[model samples]
Target chain A: MKKFINQADDFIPEMLAGIYLAHPDALRCVNDDPHCLARVGATPGKVAIVTGGGSGHLPLFLGYVGEGMLDGCAVGDVFQSPSPEQILAVTQAVDTGAGVLYLYGNYNGDIFNFDMAAEMAEMESDIRTRTVVAADDSAGAAPSGEGNASARRGVAGIFFVYKCAGAAAANGGCLDTVARVAQKAGDRVRTLGVALSPCIVPRIGKPGFQIGDDEMEIGMGIHGESGIRRGPTLPARQIADEMMSWLLADSPCQSGDEVAVLINGLGATPLEELYLMYRHVHHTLSQSGIRVFRVWVGEFATAMEMAGMSISLMPVDEELKALLAREANTPMFRQFSA
Target chain B: MKKFINQADDFIPEMLAGIYLAHPDALRCVNDDPHCLARVGATPGKVAIVTGGGSGHLPLFLGYVGEGMLDGCAVGDVFQSPSPEQILAVTQAVDTGAGVLYLYGNYNGDIFNFDMAAEMAEMESDIRTRTVVAADDSAGAAPSGEGNASARRGVAGIFFVYKCAGAAAANGGCLDTVARVAQKAGDRVRTLGVALSPCIVPRIGKPGFQIGDDEMEIGMGIHGESGIRRGPTLPARQIADEMMSWLLADSPCQSGDEVAVLINGLGATPLEELYLMYRHVHHTLSQSGIRVFRVWVGEFATAMEMAGMSISLMPVDEELKALLAREANTPMFRQFSA
Candidate 1:
């Protein structure tokens, strides 16, 4: 497909420059590498929070880096993880005197690069580092790997962990404390997404996958991985039930547990339909005796205009709730009550 | 062309039911009419803000209604305005002890219906009402209707007004004051949008307009209205200039005017490209002596994967700046002052 880019290789650099210009008050590019985008006036003594991913997810990586959320973000090309060098650059730039914490989705390439970068930071700089990978998608894991690393896959639910972890780090928590809170939030969270159609990456010009007009793939990965099953499109109620069943099965919380519900539209799904799905999700959660402390329903994490929805549930205790409620001033995340 | 909806007629009601169920704490349906959605704790006496449009724009009308934002929203069918009766029902339900203020995009059908509803409420009830139409699209106005009524087409910039007006109303501003602020925001605001491709309504199953792969339309309206001109697809920088020129002309403020800039992706544009465009927009604004106080870049107002972007400039004054700086806690908007 045709794109407006001048050259494929320059896409990331040019985009970062643009972001810096538009949001000079809120963000600035690292003076050295230019690829590392950091929040303006990020605290120096706090455990810095760094995240990076492909560039297509606008607010996901860049928009989240501001006042109360991410300290810095390294953006790669569309739908592709940044290189190890880029990740390390962002890590080094955001590392305050207290060290740095790495937070990102559980994509395979991202994990490899971020892990390598963490090791490099520890050896090269005096910076201590911790990693909390978001593995919230329950649809990708088998029942046996319910809570295991092998079965966990990160989806849109990463935003919640970013909120909780960023607040923890911003509040003067050490690397260990911030990582623990993020891990706890990740463990309690479960997400399942479905896509009606595949997204067309501008570089590729065509969809990454082919979905029939009459069908939708459940349990699909964010990168359009093959889902558990492809079946006739079901009603919103049925879809909500199917996804919620998998999420609840993977979650350790009981019916009496308090949680936050995020009914995210996978790009093309309208808000009206999202609310419909949220209705079903709320009813299902109510039937299970879960008390939803908060509800976030929108395109928090989107895949272009891919039509579908994902449901993420995060069990919240007093501490997690407090972190989630803390005042956050990021472009995409804002919760004023701690 | 297929859609998840069961029937064209059932679309709105089904979606409303789902929203109420999902956000029982944040939103509620009118006792009798399910189509009217209101915030849960929105009592009378507070200035009520109501906005609505077609159903396709997800977070725009419905997702925007929550804490610190809209008091209520009346959702129409896909890409269609709500009936006069529907608008009246929501206005009556939302009018607490104070009067109601109607805020929405500038579209003929919406204006006609909302005006009728406001008149009905004045005649039948003790509530007073005022209206502020978000006519920010600089491309759609005919040369004759230049000022308040002309040069008015509401696209994505409405989100900014919602935040500013909602904050004012939520702070207990009287209906007149709320209307004044909203109108001021609308007046200072100017938006220009262009589309690479037209959006297909779920029920329509075909694109609203046609464009070649190598061509783009400038100054297009959200609902397939004609733009300024159709030309070969241009680079990001050139496209940014085309959009900025219109916005600058539409604004009454001159160079040195501090304004809030919103670089909105029309659903399909990638974040990477958005930043690229943002870069050009920032440089152009600086060259013109405009001081950008705040810049928000994202898919705030989308047109169902239509490949385009819109730029909105709202000249800021003390009151407008304060309202913009005030905390907004909604599903879609969250701003934290550093």
Candidate 2:
């Protein structure tokens, strides 16, 4: 797998340099550390939102930093967690008198780092902070009541968490409310992905896993973690139907429920194919009497250049719908509405 | 080479079904022909802009149909031109009292079809029409003084033409003015692309072209058209510099000129890699003493799931800048400004 990179060690910094250069008007680094990136215009009195994780997932952690979204991000190298110091720096930089909320995925390293950063922020800056780790990958955990939900790996559904929590904060919610909103969204949204091909980490220089040419791994994690099963490649409709069924089985959505559908390309899948999956998902939802109120069909979260996609559904209520409709202006993602 | 598709013949219709299902509010079909997609709300007196070409390039022709962009699009099968009847239907559906403009890529099949469609519109519907073919792929033609510019392929730079022409039409420009703006934009923009891997057409189920594991092809077209040359892949910085220099040598841009840059992913390249390329592009532009006015880096136009990217530069005067900054609200693209 040939990559457009100079050196393995420079991948993250160079990518960060490129991001800062391309979006100077909207994003900035703290203390010249490219890993500690924050939005340019921070509202001082509003609660700040900060997210962090590995770097392979574009538009996930860093891309969410902007108006009506997150205020800062602590970026790590490909599939590696950021240092506690880096997280602390970002937290301190974005924190206002109103406090900061730490929102990120449910990864052990990220959890450990953010927890340490929160402690450091409290001790050193005297700032109050809250944490909400998204655990939305239905494949990684038992159904809602069967097992621990907090253990699931976060995936594309994390976008909803950011949107809901960010909207709450932008609407002048207190730190507790923002955290509560984030947690609520995280708990409600469910995602499951299928992998047609694996992706290579820049430093690794090879694919993390392999799939047969005529096979796909269903319910795979973004990092190429083992899925529920690997089987012969299926048609787009069948894939969507199976994924949607799994998601529905794990989620709280029932007849007459409304959902926000997100058909996210994992990395290398074409937008056309994602739309095909969306078509079938919509069909299944309508048959189940589930109404799709809003839809986002593109690469919202990606795993480098992996060839596959993930389907995420967030059953939305009046509050979630309003929050999801709120305006968010970021480099990779944007939404405009009430 | 696996694809997320059903029967090969159903590829286009299924994808169109997905698009229609997902965005019924913003787009609709003409006479129930899935190939003839148009914006739902057509301003009665506004000069309508219509574009069409082969399918597989999402957000190119169909994705541009909406407010402040294009009024309608005649979609086709993968890498195949739409029929003249399809184009005629779109033109008649979108054309109000104001005349319509035919804006599309400069391809042999497309030219023949659209020209036929224009003739039909004049003879049957009595709708006035003009044409502007985008020939912005600098790699496909000689520099300004050397050869006929109409022979070049229209790549991702067509986005600029759409923005300028669409803005002109939205701002109440007559058919002639919209056509003039489209022609002006088509003339000023230049693009060059590199392909790292071949893409498989759905019916073919095999790559149209192939490259070595560690090689890349520069100056490739969107539909597997042979590129200028193939060679071992270089670092991102070197690639950016080389591509930028080629564009500069062939373009009208000179020192102190302001330009908008678009670093577009072919399909499979990751966003992180695109930024690395963007970072070096900014450096190269700065070194050339050219001013960067605006930048858009993403998958604007794609070639299925081909792996690589392209860079586009458009020198802008006050007129072009204002037109480029105007608001556009399409399904895949939205610009809110000016």
Candidate 3:
């Protein structure tokens, strides 16, 4: 309930305005549709990568737009999908000779909105478009051997997808190639989150879910979806082992596999704790004979002020590793070399 | 406290170990002293910049040590100053004969410890050293013109000081010039914070400070120090106005002055909320006829999971602006251009 906001209804627009102010050189809003943010001076011939989702996840849908990253983003209110029209705005603004790519998480609302936008783009403007929905949250899907990985909900793993796909696009890859890389990221990556506390929406002024103070839920959704297992919070060593086991059980990373690691902090988790968890994650991966190509640990993605963390492991092929290492200059994320 | 830590006492060193693993390319630790971290191959002849403070205010003391920023940092336990020995270790590791600049906040413990380290370095190693303690927290200082600004505690404004001073050092500025610029940054910048809730240290397992559910404290310190006032929580707009007024009154930026602005989260504040607050901060700064040269909005310094934020305004001269605009590649901070 204690949030730094004015009128609750104005949260999304005000936040976008604030973002525009903070990262003026990196992003600009569409003329009539402020919800759409496009990179300043997007390359004329490069494929456009646009993403859209709820507003609460910082550095996700919009903050990803910049040089060597997404071409544009359509923003929505907190935990709410953007309108189809808003997604179309981004598509129209960033589209050049190359086709547009709609990249986003696999939530129901996002799926429907982005689908409509793709339809609208193809029908109205003759601008070819593709969709690469990320479903990397292993807990949201079925048992690894039985359930469809494409049906899982996306979490922090989507960032790696964005990195590779955006880099592919920036590298002047064909639309099909970009889509393929993105799809590959989706297939190779998996995430499992453990939550210690629920988050409050600025508008709602209350936590989205209720749980005991000493409890934690494994595989909790970003917006308070029920996690698979709930129990007393365990020590760092035990929790790190459990989460890593769940992730590897689903994706099954093995010896000598070149992989990228992300230890993502859910809003309130400290960087120090994230590193502590990463220490165990590093050990766990090393024990499995996984060779980490690159490691990122921070708040790459978040669920409002939720208190928890998510571990993401992306098995990296040579091509994927190259793309992941590509230059990225955004307000929140910046990588130097490809 | 429900924190992702194994044992409370193992927090600091374990966190540092995790950081070392996460960023092996950019940073390295002192072998004999794990408390000290230095940028790998810091420019040989460039003046070395070393910053340190208590732990917990992450991305502050250690995360800032990378290319084009601080050359090294001495880390301490949560809310406790680094020992003089630790500071001396970093100083000796990074000293390249251009002399060393010891930059840190003006907290009592940090001041005392860093002072001891500087003396030790001079007497033992014959390393020329200068100290530039940041006292930019307006809330912890005076009643505007009546009190000594140097008596204030350094809060988030210290980040701006670090950015400028470190950049100056990286740009081949002499030790005295770097120290002067740091001192100038410390003099011009001012910060005022508003806290809605208190934070609990994982080791303490209890709230450090207390307030009623609906109440708030203005100008609260990051370490739960007494603030200027306490009352019911106010809307973002009113709070922004009040904080801007206090900062401007203390430092008194002019109409045509170029300023660097930082909207720093105290912890547990979501990025959306931070941006929402920045909207008002931008408006207030714009209306004041002060043009923003650059703006940083995120958790630069935090007080565990405290639900609050601080606003820092640092007037920038031409030299300061150039230094602030210099490229910095750090773990948490990366700047592309001016």
Candidate achieving the largest lDDT = 2
Model 2, residue pairs in steric clash: none
* iRMS of each prediction: 2.9, 1.0, 0.9
Q: What is the C-alpha lDDT profile of model 1 across A1-338, one tens digit per residue?
A: 43546655676678778777766677777756666778878576888999988766656777788766889887777788887788787877777778788899888899999988888888888678888888888875754345466566788889889888988988889888999999999888888888888876766768999988889988887778777778988866677788888888877768899998888777656556676677777888899999888887766777765777788999899998888888877655556664
Against the true structure, what is model 3's DockQ? 0.80
Better of 1 and 2 by DockQ: 2
Number of colliding residue pairs in each model: 11, 0, 1
lDDT of each: 0.78, 0.90, 0.87
Clashing pairs in 3: A325-A338
Can you rank all candidates by DockQ, best first?
A: 3, 2, 1
Better of 1 and 3 by lDDT: 3
Residue A78, candidate 2: Cα error in Å is 0.4
- Per-model TM-score, in order, reads 0.89, 0.98, 0.98
Tens-place lDDT digits, model 1, residues B220-276: 877778888889988777778877876787677679889888888776666667778
Question: Tens digit of lDDT per residue, candidate 2, span A78-147?
Answer: 9989999999999888888899999989889999999999999999999999999898888875443234
Every model's DockQ: 0.49, 0.78, 0.80
Give the backbone clash total of model 2: 0
How many collisions between residues are there in candidate 1?
11
Residues B253-324, candidate 2: write the lDDT tens digits. 999999989999989999999998888999999999999989998999999899999999999999999999
Superposition error at A19 for model 1 (Å): 2.0
